[model samples]
Target: DAGITQSPRYKITETGRQVTLMCHQTWSHSYMFWYRQDLGHGLRLIYYSAAADITDKGEVPDGYVVSRSKTENFPLTLESATRSQTSVYFCASSIVISYNEQFFGPGTRLTVL
Candidate 1:
């Protein structure tokens, strides 16, 4: 089945350390986004890319970086993992930026101690 996948579904790390969350999509959607889901704050966009080599920051991009060297992959890296940044990260893809059909990966649960 062609869909999106996230590696290391669960991860544990310490503050000040770096952690990278990987996201891959087989559908080849033009738009991809990295979002963090936390309690009280349903979901917050961290970053997004329109195509390969083209990316931009979203609502909450601090302490995070994203790159799309290939259309199939969009990896989110937390340069300095913090306890407050601990949340379930989700990668989603869609044909457009509007409210259209989007496919999401299982999610990566990251815990920072």
Candidate 2:
């Protein structure tokens, strides 16, 4: 039984291109989150969803979009990929908002050249 999974593990794209990272969890977690990790920024929240059709922007939402059509899946899309967007993206899920431990996927490493 898989706890969480991320697609494409690694991607290389050009500037101005569009890229989507897929994330799925086997657990029926109530809260899902997207985060990007960089050298200086560390880990920054990009988006989050509380439930199906209930989504919200996180600390760093620009240049990215997210949607949760199901309780177990949350996808993140980069509208127009940029070199600065190159980072490690992670997806996490939790049973509740800040009260429970979060389960994170392996991660997707994206490089925009």
Candidate 3:
């Protein structure tokens, strides 16, 4: 099936290490978003891209970076992983931010030590 997908379904890393979570979609959605699901925060947006090479910071962008060099790919990277950063990360895509429904990929569970 052609849909959005996340890589390394689960990840474990130590503090200060750099880790990248990849998201890819075959549908060529116009917008892509990265969110972290935490205990307190329901789902906070980390970053989003309107189109290839056009990215913007969302609600929470600290310690994280995102880039969309291709419409099909949106990767989120942690410059320096921290224990507090460990959470379930979800990647979503939508054709229109206002009306279209967002399709989400299976989350990547990250554990930082």
lDDT of 2: 0.95
Name the lDDT value of residue 34 in candidate 2. Answer: 98
Per-candidate Cα lDDT values, in order, are 0.94, 0.95, 0.96
Off by over 4 Å in 1: none
Q: Which tens-of-lDDT digit does each residue in 1-113 have in candidate 3?
A: 77999998999999999999999999989999999999977999999999999999999999999999999999999999999999999999999789889999999999999
Candidate 2 minimal-lDDT segment of 10 residues: 95-104
Question: Stretches of candidate 3 above 4 Å error?
Answer: none
For candidate 1, the lDDT comes to 0.94
User: How well does candidate 1 score on lDDT at residue 4?
Assistant: 94
lDDT of 2 by residue, 34-96 (tens): 999998888899999999999999999999998888898899999999999999999999999
Winning candidate number (TM-score): 3
What are the per-residue Cα lDDT tens digits for candidate 1 across 60-108? 9999999899999999999999899999999999999898887899999
* TM-score against truth, every candidate: 0.97, 0.97, 0.98
Instruction: Please give the lDDT score at residue 23 for candidate 2.
Output: 97
User: Which of the predicted structures, 1 or 3, would earn the higher lDDT when compared with the native?
Assistant: 3
Best by lDDT: 3
